[model samples]
Target chain A: MKKIIALLLAAAMMVVAAGCGGEQSASSGSGSGSGGKQITMGFSQIGAESEWRTANTESIKQAAKDAGINLQFSDAQQKQENQIKAIRSFIAQGVDIIAFVPIVETGWDTVLKEAKDAKIPVIVVDRDVKVSDDSLYVAKIGTDSVKEGNNVFKWIDEYMAKEKKTPRDGGSQYNVVVLEGTVGSSVAIRRQEGFKDAMAKSANAGKYNLLASQTGEFTRQKGQEVMESFLKSYGPKIDILFAHNDDMALGAIQAIEKAGLKPGKDITIISIDGVKGMFQAMIDGKANCTVECNPLQGPLLMETAKKILAGEKVEKLVYVDEGVFPADVAAKTLPERKY
Target chain B: MDMLKKFAGSSLFLPVVALLVLLVFNTIFVDGFLSIQLTEDGRLYGRLVDILNRSCSLIILALGMTFVIATSGIDISVGAVVAISAAVVCTMIGGRGDGVAQMPMALAVLAAIGVGVLCGMWNGLLVAKFKIQAVVATLILMTAGRGVAQLMTEGQIITVYYKPFEYIAGFLPGMPLPTNIFIALAMVLLVAVLMKKTSIGLFVQSVGINATAARYAGINVTLVIFLVYAFSGLCAGVSGLIESSLIRAADANNAGLNMEMDAILAVALGGTLLSGGKFYIGGSVIGAITIQTLTTTMYALGVSADQLPVVKAIAVVIICLIQSKKAQEMFDAWKARRMSKQNGKKTSVDGKVAEQA
Candidate 1:
């Protein structure tokens, strides 16, 4: 009798779960069907692992709602296999459009080809996917990481000029310690490339020396640990810090404080990814500057989807104009910053 | 000669030799590999200090692993348990203030450790009562643990700003070394004393050697197995606290990634057989330090992060070769052959001399 009761309870619970799933899908289906020739969009996100990612997911969800477009969302949880599965499922559902932020670059050819054969257009976001066929994805929307890195150096150049400390004019020599993101990641590579390229073009190029550059793995904890070691290695000679992301910058701030130095003033910090934490740091004068890698691409993305659905030609690549945020503007813009 | 032979034949001899060899290699090839200095804050800083400091979590994990492996059982869910503990603690604290404990930090820590113990109990129940294979049973938690953490944190990285909390993994006021090192040492001493002062250690070894035989011998085999896994879970909880405090956040996905593998490797490198039996806690501690030192050395040498794993794999292979019984036997056989060949030449020379005479 107990076993029978347990089985019934389990079955009832499963029924409730299935019902909930049905209601969710049905609402989305109704939402898409309500408008004239409603376009359904299936978006595969790379899971909400960080604050930035969570904001990104929220942006897309909110954008789809505001645009009155039916959206099917899949959280891949940072796995390529899960992303591929989500994409294939979208294809099977025959959604009007398929879009995803890929976890990695490779191993998507077969799945993308499947989407291509199904006559569905796929939009890539945040991260790029490498496929043999060009038409696999209709468009890619992401910030130029190289430009972001270049902006960091440009901010430094202007700051030095304002201080009347241009290195090339026999002013002050600056020593920099770079905290890179995950090594071999395209974002990390391009950011490094852009920074180096900018440095070459800058007038203070000869006066700047790279003390030590190491991978922080794009994590705050690693950034702090790496910064701790850098402090031990370089000590007072370190003049500036260039981190790949805001999390690393935040971490380096803690490390610098622990080392008994003012982070923004003593060791000028320039990082990419203008997340709220970095903005807060800037307002507090703990971070010198940050280059924006806008996570709120949802509005623009949904707009593009609407245009694509209308049979309008779209560009192969859409570059989001992300600007650098300095300490002064951080306070005023903190209220309006979406992500 | 007799003492040297005894030392060489000890179970811990290989691990010690491996550690010494690594230290020598690092000192010779890596620049300032042995340098230690005191900063203005009076904290000891250097590659060696970094290795010791970083190895605290691994050392704690390996301590639990030593007992679990001694019972011929493995707990692969320790890493996941770490994530769960971090989530519980960070969420409880909830980033209340300027690195200040919103609630009593001690309570939050205890709650996290309690969750760890509960997780261990679940594993123990599965293995001890349900008779599920240890790996598969732990694998269930290993897969679900991170997800559980994600659920607890609502898929957001919970960054805590509590200052006192950082002391768990960071330096305390006027203290040169990290508090984690002391905590790890205390755990080792506690476990070591328990094994030494009681019959529990012998029962665990007997059960691991032969469960059926031990049951017949009147040992509480199930109880021993259960306690071992529960203990492993507790160690994972401690490691979770240290890790979360160190990072000042609860990152469910990345907190303890691949840590179980490292713990298992440390145990194996410590000369504890995966098949189970006699175990050494001290050896496991040293083994954890060795792994950390290798990582620090790689980083110091400026090896690109992508290539560090390749170098680590090659070093792991070399260490395994040194530890394998088959390789030892082959080496012995080669040495015997060389000795025999020299003897043969000696005899031939004597024969020629005789002929000349």
Candidate 2:
């Protein structure tokens, strides 16, 4: 009986191993059978934590299909360890290229070094990584948050000038309040610095006084609460409201309406991240403007990957082009927004 | 004086005093903090109203948490359960372009609550039947519930545009206050009656005190534990409804995020023992209000967002110290020592007078 059981166990192991081997060979065969050499790329995503992320993932998947690249995808579910595991597995699978949206800025040196040893070029997408050696990854593709922030104040200056709403030489000061994003985040810190820089450089810099700035934690609820207190403290004296992201601006709009004041008219509302909800708010005349932080980087990433595989020189830093969406254009552009 | 002492000795005392202290600080430091104005739409608009309005959900969560803690069990899954409930309701009432609910509002709400109760039953099964640790059992749901919610929403944040649906968190026609305040009040009253009129409360206390002893006393320990968790799920469901309605969207990632910690903290601030037995619903309600008031005060003062948590922690520590029984006992001992010293001084004075005579 013992000998029979051992034979059965050995037969089961052979069948499982044969199944895996068949799958491996079939995948490789299909990869080579395509019109030309198909580039096999493994991409690790951070997770679908927000609409922006989901749209970003969709763009990558669709782009990979359009580019005829064999894409091996894994979701890290917002964990760095999971991302590292995915990268190691991709190395074992010996994919031609590896790309990932690093969940954090640090702790990728070892795994990335392993990928380099395997001769698999790595592309860092969306969020960046801080590896000891820059050669660990071939390229980084993401939006410049500081530039997005600078664009916010620049557009505000242009809008005010166009509307002739800029404060006169001796007119009452324009009190501005800011609804910041999650504290200590890189995006938040950079955006704030950029805004401050532009504000100082603006033509009417001295005419604007910063009434208050507080963190909204990048949520609608906290944004509404903080906005409510701001209204109570500063009242209708506030002429402008700047939110670090669209969600908080949407919340502030609700609070503004509840306080019996018109949002865009009473307080010019400007925020970052041109999300669909923000566009809707703009179309409704609740918000004024949003500086776009584009998440659709699929095509750019594919082009870069093709360039890298062809032994072509690619820029180490690649930034996707973004635009500013004002209230007047929101109605026309809302339909085209994929996010 | 005796009545004051009795009032001070009650479980509700510390929470109430904490709330009052926050309110008083705001009144003194924040401009127009105590003033309430009527909006053109006839709703009350002010920071005070915001505190009450926002705290309603936390109060409801704390109410349910109170019962679960009284059974010596924690429901860390309530936050995730809130996300699940929100997802269920929002999806069932699909986001049609015409802004119409796919299903009846009442039916959608009931379905959400039903799903929550089902989740609770799963946790209860693991903890009560499988003899799993409560934290581990609830942690399973805590981790998986958000994933389940994400699946239900198809990884999208479902925004409900149905105008009538807004009344869950917003004001009804001509209403002076938010609907959530009334919902919270009704829940508190319902739970208060349940504890006062039924022997279920006693059963829960017995089970919490000692399950072995409770079983010997003819108490259905398993049923008691199961029911409390189910009740917690119910509270989470109602809270989910209020929260989703506030934003008019069901955010699977952010809805009720870290709410379990807030609920647990409120329970602790209410002077409830972590090792459960007797509990007070009113104390928890006051505790919830106090926390919201603290948040509002921080915002009112315009504290930097990065430093807000640190300031909040300091406030919570001060309140907890004030509520600590050991601190109170120590104070009493010090007072007694001073009283004895005074009496000794008086006797010595009399002895000197007698010697002079």
For every prediction, compared with the true complex, DockQ reads 0.30, 0.54
Question: Largest TM-score belongs to which candidate?
Answer: 2
Residues B1-357 of candidate 2 have per-residue lDDT tens digits of 999999987878888887788889899999999999987778888888999999999999999899889999999999999999999999999876468989999999999989988888888888888889999999999999999999999887787878888899889999999999999999999878988899887998889888999999999888888888888988999999999888888889889999999999899988889899988789889889888899889999988888899999999998888788898799889877866676677755656444533
Report the lDDT of model 2 for residue B93. 91
Where does candidate 1 stray beyond 4 Å? A1-50, A57-123, A129-132, A163-173, A257-262, A302-313, B1-9, B324-357
Taking chain B only, the TM-score of every model is 0.93, 0.92
- Give model 2's TM-score versus the native structure: 0.87
Q: What is the interface RMSD of candidate 1, in Å?
A: 2.7
Q: RMSD for all candidates, in order, please.
A: 7.9, 7.4
Worst 10 residues of 2 chain B by lDDT: B348-357
TM-score for all predictions? 0.83, 0.87
User: Per-prediction interface RMSD?
Assistant: 2.7, 1.6
Give the per-residue lDDT of model 2 (tens digit) for A97-169. Answer: 9999999999999999999989999999998788788988999999999898899888877777688774322
